[model samples]
Target: MTNDRGTSSRRIFAGIAGGFLVSTVMTTPASAQDDPQHGLADIIVTAQRTEGRLQDTPVSVALLSGEELATRGISDPAALQGSLPAVQFQPVGDVLANIRGIGTFNLQPGADAAIAYNVDDIYIAHATGLTPVFFDLARIEALRGPQGTLYGRNTNAGAINIITNRPRLGRLSAAAQVQAGNYDLIATEAMLNLPLGETVAVRISGATQKHDGYMRDGHNDADIYAGRIRLLFAPDQGTELLLTGEYSNQSGLGAGGSSPCLATFAVAGCNRKGWDAYAGNETPVPDDFRSVENIGINGQLAHDFTWATLTAIASWRRVDYASLTTTGDANIPFGDFGYKPSNANQLFTGEVRLNSLASSPVQWVVGAYYSREKMTNRIDRTFLSDTLLGVSEVLDRYRATSRALFGQVTVPLGSRIRLTGGLRFTDEEKSASGVATNYFVVPAASIATGGAESHSGLTWKAGIEADLARASLAYASVSTGFKSGGVNQTPAGFGIPSSYAPERITAYQAGVKNRFLDNKLQVNAEVFYYRYTGFQELLNIFAPGYLAFYTVNSQKARVYGGEIEVVAMPSPDDRFEASLALLDTRFTRFDLTSFGGADYSGNELRNAPPVTANVAYQHRFRLGSAGELTPRIETVISDKYYTDAINSVAGQQASYTQTSASLRYLSANGGWSLTGWVRNLENEAVIYSYFGGRGYPLAPRTYGVTLRFETR
Candidate 1:
């Protein structure tokens, strides 16, 4: 039910954006501080962990730089969807991010992840530990709404910060790259920055990737490996320390194994089958694969004492995953295979912070947090059948603990208004134990019917700000968030309910942050509203002879959204960007009596989508000494969404428009570079769905070439 990304690649990207916008003409805008091009380049965000200046942070953030992720060739994180604005990325097998419509499509282990992924600030409770291949980066921030006063708990659908690239004491940089495209694509990356004088410094990074997958058979494929190490320490004027270690390993072929399509003309709603083809069904899983291993460590410390400034952060993580599939009858594929789903997780986190220096107008902060988690799940559908029909065999074990205490403040009503407040208090506990067999696997019992449960909460935020000039700012906020409640690894003949609760949100926001003319143009806008009381959903109850997975509770819901971001540099060689998002998710009350008694009130909320937009353009050329050339184009648009939540018929995802392009070259003064890229380019038919529509296909027109080197 997905097709359409054609029209000769939109007339070849509108004839290469109309011959480069009529021979480009512009200047100034590089976050202009006396002209680094004259504007748009002053982004310093800690998203409230301190440091501000992203148009004065009124939250509606979306900053991605690392040279704009290698001039738009974006590496990973599910390709970051529209890069912002309603941000929705669902590549399952761990990678389901939804902002503004909330997210989480049950990854099991009692499910928990309503957006809240961090890197440099720790906190990354699985998602396969992010970045399947985004290299040494230095920025990526997207904060939408309900961040619960400086990020706490699951964040209620907001917060994503990944800041890499640290370790520079005296500075001695180096970099490397290599890539080749089309199906047999290969990638390699390297980085080193070592300096041991005046107080240590060291950094090392690595990446490797392989590809061959576009599914239509030929069994999807890809393998990846990653590594990182960083350490920095300085003990003078005001102490500093940082340490990190990371790892990643993945084996693919999984994402595409779950493909099932049959909607040549169904007739439901939300574009049920936008085009035609394949109404027969029969792709019976065969080469479905998955493997992931992750490891991590992080430690950071800082001290300033000029009046006060002390911080500490620590984290440790581990994840392991395995997969295999064939949910039976695709027209009979070897009769319902088994031993697929698997997981193993371990995580730990710690935080401590305090600040108060610069007296006078008053400003403050305080923090404390702790976390501990452990999970183990393995479901094997004990198989054996030619008519033998044997089932059962499951195992689940979970444990969780969290503690929190937070604070915030800011006061000054005179010189441009300002007043903010924050609070956080949390204490959580979860427990589970299981075992179920007998289908020839013996031992059938103990699924922990209902055991351990504890939840405590208080999440808050109150805001008011005004600057209106000197870069601009205007904000208003009210927030609350938290998501914690566990058990429910289902499957043990689906007796359901190990436990479930703790899902809450209350958000209301207003924003405006601008930087005009002299600054080359930067605008940010936001409007949000959310109130979900116990909306923790993950339903698929079709019992008449099997298949049940639950984690319900949807008493009330309503999510409002509005987002806008625009950046323009008119000069300094041209750059333009735009974004927009408008959403209105529903479900005023959902009552699913295990499937028959369905009262899904307003419906519409699975992967929520009301509208989305995008635009981008780039220009810069100066081949004088045979160096420097840049050309780019981008476009993304979507509308018509329903991935499920009582909206069946293979849950639609119709409306589509996607395009990408690039050309880069730099030398003279820079250590060498080259790039040529093309992605999707309208060869689009990208569908990555599951839950009764089963489709996973992304990658349709790929082109590549990259070679780079650097040193400083």
Candidate 2:
């Protein structure tokens, strides 16, 4: 890290420290029982596959409840960047999440994401399905660092768990909400719960949204519809069953790109354009409309025994989508790079586990997991010029299978210490077959290619925790992570490798959780370091008269980071929260053997900002015999970062800050509420991603109002 960047990180941390010191010295101790509204509320989580308090879990994780999600208007993972420490997002038609500088480097089919995403304990195999599962959720947990032992494969970065609200045994309740905003935006959501019998209950929920484009010519809009149904059956106190079904459809003038010249230094050959302008060469540029449809069904059964509990889970899901998008040469006119791709995927998963009862002195869990996925896809390409015209079509089929066995045990030592250990063994296999035909060639040419690959590995974790005080705990752990390799679908005779190697990581982490001022103030801090090997890197080869995509393994790399979070509730009406994260990453040894042995060692990893911070404050006022009003303000700051492995000037994003505010009013009976909100008050055109010469900017200034009602 540079001296300037280091100094900037220190200054941010200093500000957070200042606030903590003031809250500690100025506030008087008060019992939470007497002043219930002045202290933080309890948050329950299932990070370790069981119910537990957030502060008691021995890991670095963040949680956001359903109420928080609705209040902040956060319906997808892309909107969770600054709300959590050591987290970031990049949207390239499909949303991708990054934690602690590790994320997906390959966007091709059959490639797995570093961050594992799960909905109600069921793994989601594809990125296109992540958005729809966020609705009607109870809470979402983001675990930072490696979570390979319990989560199994493809969790080198971390994991996200989305827990939904289940049916109540005997209750009748309903809620509805409507929102209207600028850009002709409108959204509606509703939910209902009903009891069928003494042992059966059902819940249903749906949401729909539409909005105009953010582009200058009204492109890049959003249209989404989703619904879910859950049924719960409890035969007796020892046995329970739950079934879930979901469907969603998303269609719009999807993601559009702008010229990078608008965000970087002006160059002689660059074409400067506005952030909202589309960067393309086609005359009367066509809208990049895309659509996705998904369906899923899952079931869970559990039985409690005298000594242990047995649980089983099974799920099936399908996703279909189509898109038309511009490729490289986004800034050059008359470029021949565009394509339309259509795909369908089907997946099935099953798991069985057993764990000791909560009263057991030595808590233990054992589980086995299995998953299979099949995909079919077709791509149509067009390359036209003054001298020649070429059109090509490729049809491909792919399949993947995975199996795992995992176990974890925790034992108490003495009176204030505990030891934990875990292990998981995973086996994965992938195969692909494809045929390509080119029409504009001399007499037309056709080629075929197919290959298969398999990988197996063992991942483990061990940790120790100690209670320093009644309201404080300290813990440390070392863990390993794994992501399987896969085959490429490119045709033969192109010198493209058929497959890539698996990537692995060893992470060392330590943290402390503490509450002060009579439990009204909380402060948590953690630091982590990773030794990464066989890093998979996706390469896009663009040359004269040729275009190719491939993946290769980088020899080695290193990543290190730290985070601090503070929350203070000085009084019943005032609240404050702040967080800061610092990161440093580097590729220790990497060589581009396919590109004439070009060495790229010592380069910083892409999207790994050296400094990031968030700060927020809120205050509530009581209206005598009427209602209550609350207002909030927040700001997020990020340092300059690169969007490509090469770190080109065109892919660099400068430091920027964004601010948002909201005012909410609630009825005296707590049955209805209204909120007015505004985001990005400065209308800053902050670049989030770069594709060749094309740049994608974050949303500009937006304002809206929401009205909600419910039965209490």
Candidate 3:
């Protein structure tokens, strides 16, 4: 079946490729070129912990401006999968983000994500903190591959840096936007900036969105409210301080679960392909809902000296999340059961660093970092009947602490070549305790367990970059990444291991960046290889009369991939951009002793599609003495991929394409605008996870209109 799908995918892309070719030929002319006033704009990034042009950064990075996000109707990180290369997002109980085929699958508090999500240079220890801070942002940077030195542990896959708009010392401005759409959608956003004195300023922003469910049973809905405030103080030329506070609340029915067919592919909707409108055998439980609340505060201080600059950062965040979902298993005695999970997580982090002046011949930075995370997790199981019947419950508490010292240096070898090296030493410790109770038993028996462990490691990176031309760069690098080990809070009588070993990865990569046609065309390409060891995998063991969950280390794996991105502005009125990623990943040796000693070796990793591509085109029509009209079309393509490590037939999400289109009109002064947009034109419903022979789908087709206003 996989082979047949591969052939079918090839045929589909052939047609798409032809269509793109003809469109380009019809819209672009040989005489058309970028005018002196317009071309590809420069993108500034801080991928290396310093501000620089994106083209000059040695790391592989993808940057998206806040304006672009708003225009595309992207309100959260989970929506980034279709628009970015080598990235995927799935929102289960908590958000799961993957980059380059590496991510977290375990939901335990003791487990850490391979990909790190950061806001304003402060890392978010948990994924729940990442869902609500997508508004009023300067830009978002997706750095691919291991961020070993600059970002210490839990960055085996890479990092996402979300830079928010800061306070302006001498500006007073305001902006507001509102949107209305089908499915009873309504969204509003506002921003205000005020200058308090000659050296003090403040910026405040807020957003709220509410929409009805998109499912036939009204299971998928949205309700979100978020706000942020920034305060800046710069009393002198050499010293600066910035403080930020944020809060968010999200509550609704959340995402629904729908399957095209039951496992074995012989049930209701068996003949369906994509997007069955809640017609599966599974039924939604009453009062199914999800909620998350987050609060965060952080501060940054910097002092510049003659030879170098010293900086300090401190942050604290608290996240409370809960969800109630149905198991959707018809085989159960009474009916589908309800699964409710809740968590209260808190994190505290601090860092101190110093960086050499930009004018120095050799640039360097040294830093020390510390972080502590604590969480209380609980899960309850109940029968979904008129009278709820308690079945089972589990309660756990986890704590983790980490400390690191890191440094990086860049030395000029010649006029056009530079050498770079970095090292980081990390120490981490984790402890967990839990109690499990079974109410189904006559007397409701219970068991308790607890343990602690510590681990340490050293990770490093080395690279060299050279200027190929005035506007081009070529570079190569190798880096190592680490994730801390964790304890399993299960009864010792189960004979399960007390702890699991840490996971590691070594990555080698090379890339080239280039600009041509007088900055009218930009192209970037990269290839990478990774050697992964001690892959951490969560396992379920069914003992004589009880079930236990624990994490284990798989043998090894190999991952190789390549990506290419192109942006062309043949003329000021026309723009075209495309990106493609090719990935090959396999578990070289994976033997699951608990699951009847089955071997999943030679299987492809979950969510790692062999081929993925995104293409977008837009054109502007200028109206003299009036506003301008712009229309845009975009498509995202993906090859077939699995949703679980076992790679079962029911877990395979077939190859598909999702398309979206939008039209916008802007006034001559650019202070006001209106946009009409539609996403998933064909209503492609791709499943993100599979459970109890059922598949949970993503968003469906939707249309909306947005109006924006700003004061200068």
Q: Cα lDDT of all candidates, in order?
A: 0.71, 0.78, 0.79
Q: Give the residue spans of candidate 3 off by over 4 A.
A: 1-37, 131-133, 256-260, 265-283, 328-335, 383-396, 491-495, 539-549, 594-597
Model 3 per-residue lDDT at 404: 96
Clash list (residue pairs), candidate 2? none
lDDT of each residue in 1-712, candidate 1, tens digit only:
1234224333433433332232121211323453544556677888877776777766887778776676566667766675666777776666678887787877566467887888888888757777577888888897877687667988788888889899888888889888888878798888898999978898999888887665544334568889899998887858889998989888865443444554545563223544321111244445556888898888899898877889899888888887765544342233454446777888889999887875537888888989888877766543435544344434456788888998988888899889989899998898877764344333433333335678887888988988755666777888888787676655445545556787888888877766667777766666677988888887755443234456767888888756666788988878898776767777888876563557887787876666677888888897778778988888788765667777665556666877888898888777878888886688766554535545554546777888878884
lDDT of 2 by residue, 1-712 (tens): 5678768766755654454444334433344453445587767888888877787788888778887777766665555656676787666667777888888856577788889989998889767876542567798899888999988888888888888889998899999988889889788889999999899999999888787766654445678889999999999999999999999898876655444353355541122334442433333246466899999999999999999999999999999989876544435434645667788989999999998998898889999999999998777665556655444445467999999999999899987899999999998999988876666567777778568889887899999997776667788899998887887766666666788888899999888777777777888877778998988777765544445567777889999777888888998788999888888788898877664445778777888888888899999899977999999999889888876777666667777788888899989998999988888887777666665566676666778888888889
Return the candidate ranking by TM-score, descending. 2, 3, 1
| Candidate 2 Cα errors over 4 Å, as ranges | 1-3, 6-36, 260-284, 327-330, 333-336, 387-395, 438-440, 594-597
What lDDT score goes with residue 541 in model 1?
54
Candidate structures ordered by lDDT, highest first:
3, 2, 1
TM-score head-to-head 1 vs 2, winner:
2
